[model samples]
Target: MSESKQDIMRFPPSKITDVAKALSGDLRVRILEALGDTQLSVTQLAEALGVAQPTVSINIQILEQAGLVVTAQGSNREKLCSVSCRSILLELPSRPGDGLHKTEEIRMPIGMYSLCSVQPPCGMANRDGLIIGSTDDPRAFYMPERTDAALLWFSGAGYVEYRFPNPMPPGVSIDELRLRAELCSEAPSFRMDYPSDITVFVNDLPIGTWTSPGDFGDRKGKLTPDRWTSGTEYGVLTEWSVRADGSYVNGARAAATTLERLSLKYNQPIRLRFEIREDADNRRGINLFGSAFGDHPQDIVLSFIRFKEHQEGKES
Candidate 1:
């Protein structure tokens, strides 16, 4: 794929130090995270970060010097700053005694999912926490602007899938693969004891299942808008990993599947499917958390681990 179209950004090892230094400050990192896609004036950034404008300006200068941020004169000659990249990633080989190999991670916004097969009570909201189409309507999922969804939920068994492009070099076999998301059961009412059997599939291969405890509306989600109080709030951040031994959820063995059995192709798209099987012991439904409305500020994430020397690293 062309550099302009690449999903994950890769940098040669020569850039490790500079990038690391630029990202070393917590305030600068927060600034980048808050910038998202739209340009934010320095004052807006300060307000969002709860910091003074001068503090934000100082950090923005550092980011500008490192080429990670760009500034433009806005209305009234005010300076607006924005991150230059959608995401930044770095791969590192595992140190001795660590249980893994080299790893690369990517965060896929919930709305960027490539496909879906959902049922009613299914709807999505944008970053502002406004419903995109209509509540309890399946047609909402088909809207062209669904990519703006910051939170999605449904009431029955089905799946939402994402197709991640494979960027590894030829012959680089993965030792382990992990998918993490903040999710829970979806209910019309906040049912604390409700259980949903949520399953994850990689490239159509079943990895494992996680039983979400409930819809969890006991408290407002850390990032959820104040206006969203009656609906499900936050979800549990869960991780499903397919290792050399077997599939694991939250560090416990959950399935008998193995890494090699996944048959992850080196040059083909990797499809991730999250479903609540029709015959599942518990079909409480599913609620997928997104960066803007979840207690955990992230969408679905995928991590690739290579036990041996990664050819792609050298190529970068």
Candidate 2:
């Protein structure tokens, strides 16, 4: 099955038994194995399973009833059945009615970064569409009023770092650490062909790199101010997660980085950095959009799930 980040089917504790029952039958499991990640019509499934069409259809109905499969009409009007999702995550709450098993999250504003070592073409602007300080000056990032900045940009090999306050309870361990931001490559104005390798560091450890496809500006951004008619308009919402096994960017394995190397064992602040090295193959620069300047109405966000020993044992 596809392990795409957004391709998970999460079920509540109440529905776990129902889904389990759907997979109890050997014929249904075989049907799913035949389908894999592809969709197949009843006739096609029957042929693949070497079973009668009527039998295949009956099993398909049972799987659909348990929300294990989805049926849709094909181009030729033939019925198509597919395993609903690439993977399934069942949240077994420590106690009943835990409400989707909430996780700790922090929506850090873009301008709240603690430090920045940047170069020319660096600048910041407020929500009113006014520059915070002089453009192409790294000193502008240190201005006191930068907290109100709605947009920021910088070029060359440097980074903007944030020291997030650690609020984890003593003795608790984290299962995953995630960060999401709306960003894109920077150019003179905006270029559709520019690309840049942006790397993310957590606890001062290199975790992953997401190569921005390009500086997106074909059309005006939905949240961009009307007066700001030129230059880069928007960015893509990218997510990076560090897990026990390795690091992942938008569901794809990005690197061999894992939580153990992050030095997150202690309850200390997390220093996160987005850096573009001087030797990068694509050094187009970086553009970070705030809540008021990007297509997405958000800045930088950090989130994670903590696993207590008892809860972990119960879940396992």
Which regions in candidate 2 have their CA more than 4 angstroms from the true location?
1-101, 306-316
Summing lDDT over every window of 10 consecutive residues in candidate 2, give the lowest-scoring window: 93-102
Worst lDDT run of 10 residues, candidate 1, spans: 92-101
Q: What lDDT does the true structure give each of the candidates?
A: 0.82, 0.83
| Model 2 residue 100 lDDT score | 23
- Report the C-alpha lDDT of model 1 over 1-316, residue by residue, as the tens digit: 1232234456445345556778999999999889867689998999999999998988899888766788999878999887767666665533221222267677898988788888987788887778888888888888888888888998779989999876455556677788889999999867888999999988787888999988899888999988776578899999999988999999999888898887777668888999999999999889998888879988888998766654443445
Cα lDDT of model 2 by residue, 5-44, tens digit: 2387888765666678888999999998988878799999
TM-score of 2: 0.66
Superposition error at 93 for model 2 (Å): 14
Clashes of 1: 0
Superposition error at 295 for model 1 (Å): 0.8
lDDT of 2 at 237: 95
Q: After superposition, how far is residue 65 of candidate 1 from its true place, in Å?
A: 12
